[model samples]
Target: MAERLIPRQALEYIKNKKLRPAFSYKDVWNEEHAAAFTVAKTMQIDVLSDIKKAVEKAIENGTTFEQFKKELKPALMQKGWWGNKEMSDPLTGETVTAQLGSDRRLKTIYSTNLRSAYQKGQYDRTMESDLHPYLMYRIGPSLRHREQHLRWNNLIRPKDDPIWNSIFPPNGYGCKCYTVAVTEARKQKYERDGVPAYNPDTRKTVRLPVQTEAPKPSYRSYFNERKGTLERIPEGITPGFNWNQGQSGRTIPVLQECLKKAQNEMPEAVDSVIRTLQNSTIYRDQLSDFVDQAYKHKIDGKANYKNTAPVGFLDKKLTEFLKTEGIETSGRNLIVLEERLILNGKYSGRHTDDGNAPIQQDWKNLMDYLADSPVYWDSRQKKKNLLFLKKITESRYLKIAVDVLSTERYLKLPKVDTMYYLNIATENEIGISEYNEIMKLKKIR
Candidate 1:
């Protein structure tokens, strides 16, 4: 039997020149949520081919559809059976990338709706409508990822990290990972019941709820094993050695040691110190102490201090350096901003966080020490590179496509196979009422 290509119904996909069947796998294989499609009458044949496989698997198990449902409920705990219904791609032997919890009748109904749209040119936009089209497009693959990660995706330990050492090795490289696609309607059904609408191929009315956002990977989770070693440093040493004005220099390598210890044990305290150092007065005081301690300057009493040139100008110089890097001015808001930036890069694409900022060599040394310690071991290194690329590409593509599709010049044509072709239809916005009116004209049952 020949393989079947289950195409999407969105006109944007059908009429898209960039999404030819030849290149459709690019969309299929990526984390990006764009669907590949084309409009034609025979496409339903493809869906039937897919259905035939599900039926065949049922028959192979010596059960009819009715019998399979009962057996499947228990058998779903088995490796091959994921949910009440078993799904697979006959061509590649890959699992179907739809939510397992969706209405089983939805696929049959959606098929009917498409048949109607093909013949009568109308149906509830909510029923196999563009809204549902995009909604399924997002959530179908989301289920795929959640399943893959929980079942298939493995964590690899870094060579230097002991905790993840046994977690498994990394992907060879260029691994194409798929994540969950989420949308409002699918969410409602999932919440009301424990099941998600896994069958995007199905078309039935399932209540929609607001989308559940995917959870983000946190720094702590990534580097949990290293947290233990990073907390030993004292606060004073983390800043650096400092001496009084015009007095004999004091030695304070212990201060540097203290800072190093706090890197893991006390990040909040570390941050506090950084902020304190940002103040010109505190920075100068600390610098003077550091210089005096290092034998670079002499600290004296108030009279000597007044007569002497300003101590430690390095603090102001360091502040300017930090600004050139991604660090923002010190404040509560900026601190939160820094945290977000450090983890996810700039909230908006236009800016980055303070991780890029230049710091005093002492600060750098302390960070390097922390990096060596277990606490900061799982800090941003490998994943940051991947995340940076993912953010840029996904944001750019979605924005561009939506901007084009919502424009008037892209008026849709009623094409075969429930697809939209670019034609002479009015380019006016297809309002919710207009969509409903079109459905009413078709007399959807």
Candidate 2:
């Protein structure tokens, strides 16, 4: 019962809730060791010397050796001590001799040296004068038993309670761990002395004792590791350097069928869009104000008005306004904002009256408000408009779909539409024609 229940019961009885079972002596020693290393190095004193002095002082202050070991857990952890293997008697499996802590192993040797120095204590006190007491004071807490508990508390969680589950596994006696101290300076020294050096002037070199040849990586591994994420690929192809190229293709008839469906659906779509536009009070007013401004620009063209007409002037002005609103302006004359505002998992697209991308569906929503909304026109007229609008819409959606499919293997195809859109076009050809009397609708791109 004591193995499990005693720890919990004793911990509960202790006034300091932090005195728990899981927080073991090893943990305390580790923290103190770390604190000692930090404080000693920060003071720029020899760490080993400061540690010995601090230990002697603690012993004089009446700290039992066993209790000192328990408290030194934190410092040991900080100092980076790693306990070496133990040598045991083969017959009994009991170790007769063990090299434990550095202090434990060196205690006898240190005593012999101290005794030799004792005779010269008054005549030549090297130990007393050489030891830095002030620097030791800074790291004093890390060297003492109570200071060990303080550091352990700082490291372990739930400072007010013991966490028994976190304890290290118990092992044979004298198998205590230790820490090792290593600095960047030491590493640099090792690099300088350990590595072979070559003299370029003499064309001679010294070889290292332990030589190593780095493994050569495969071509595939090298290519993958050095590949750029954003590199562009050929049309209808995704950017991948794999042997088998990725391609995107759909049956030509399927594309034609999708085209037909897009046309069939546009009358209702356009009518719906026009209604929304007519109903928007703010949008209607904004559109009117922009058209008026563009018309003014057309009149100012005067002698140059031959190329610049009122309709052309309105497209550019409206497009500029759209740009200010964060709508992507791709082509000079084409303004496409293919965003859907979702409501209850159902979406309605907004587009311009002519079936272009910018027409807000709100215009068609105003169809009830406007009695003559082309949406309410005869089915024959609506069908004609739908066919034209479908042609344009399918062209745009095709570009998107083709680009997506191009990433798959074996579906590669030429992106004729994508290239057409990518070509350079003069202002008039692309839709930025100056305000003129003979306003003509630009060709579908």
Candidate 3:
């Protein structure tokens, strides 16, 4: 038999997507959380809680549709959300009860959750594997189909195509549709030798150009709405299904690469330094949890004197610099944050907890490290003859240099390393020690 065009869904995939999906809820008027249909809230406190619990259980240990309904029904009934009854409302104290549990409502809840979860899981896989750049839309063989769905049945677009971000599968109630990521090689092959087509005359499959364009409805093509914003879902998409599944999976950057595309830098939104390094290039299998705790010291916050703060190289060349400093070699990973070192009262021990040793760098004397650190290169703003890293290196491999703010300089307990903060600070804010370090590293040549 010839190679099939439609790839069969992996049997295990249903369980996977059932556990995770990109969920975006907006009301009829496009207000988030306030939307009529939401995964976490369905306009009923009891119903919402029950559904959330059921969903969590599904994610925790894959639950069947029957199992979910069996567990959800009784809980909802006990909470007075079963099929509609009137009582004192919490918000207005008015006695009002709307239609609660029904076959249709339960069906809606079940399908919506499964669809969104699958979509998100697929999108995560798509992002992880950068090979497939195109997504092919496939509509089900349903007898009753939306005309628009039929029009978009066989449409294929680039993965980054704006249209895919706006519209994907399950665009309406009971709509059975999905997309498959197509590889570049497959795209080239199909373009060169058109897909197999049945020819009446020859009685055999013949090559024909695969369709690229389709009729897309003009209205409501995009929605940039947020909470409290009244907007409408994109045309031809389900009311609560307008948000892009893939983009929704573009969650807060746990790894550095995820933030590479960000317009503004938000470090606080990142995962723990140790977990981040574990997933990223900063990992050391032998170091364990200490791998993260070792290099993580706060560069911006005061070292609180009692508790330690996090910090690091915070650059792509961190490993390189560590190698050059002879501090972090291939097998030996010993870059402890300055806060981890003991300051006073020498105690009997095999290895001293001092960061000021030949191998260790003290957090109290961070300026010393900065003075000898590598220079940054700026392609967008650099002038050819400008001087940088004059006291450190002749090269400028980085664009940004950090400085400690003067107003925020003094810690309750000051140490030579504790003078500068570890975060992004400007020249005006730089304390004397930090300013001197900057001058040493990137002054006018």
Error of 1 at 224 (Å): 18
TM-score of each: 0.16, 0.13, 0.48
RMSD of each: 30.2, 31.4, 14.5
Which scores greater on lDDT, model 1 or model 3?
3
Query: lDDT of candidate 3?
Result: 0.44
User: Candidate 2 vs. truth: CA RMSD?
Assistant: 31.4
- State which candidate has the highest lDDT: 3
| Cα lDDT listed for each candidate | 0.25, 0.24, 0.44
Q: Best-fitting candidate, measured by TM-score?
A: 3
Clashes of 2: 56
Candidate 2 lDDT over 122-222, as tens digits, reads 11221123331110000111223332222222121211111211111111112121111223443344345652446456778853321121122122221
Give, for candidate 2, the lowest lDDT window spanning 10 residues: 241-250
Per-residue lDDT value at 437 in model 3? 47
Q: Which has the better TM-score: candidate 2, or candidate 3?
A: 3
Measured by C-alpha RMSD in angstroms, how accurate is candidate 3?
Answer: 14.5
On a 0 to 1 TM-score scale, where does candidate 2 land against the true structure? 0.13
> Where in model 1 is the C-alpha error above 4 Å?
1-148, 151-174, 180-185, 193-268, 272-445
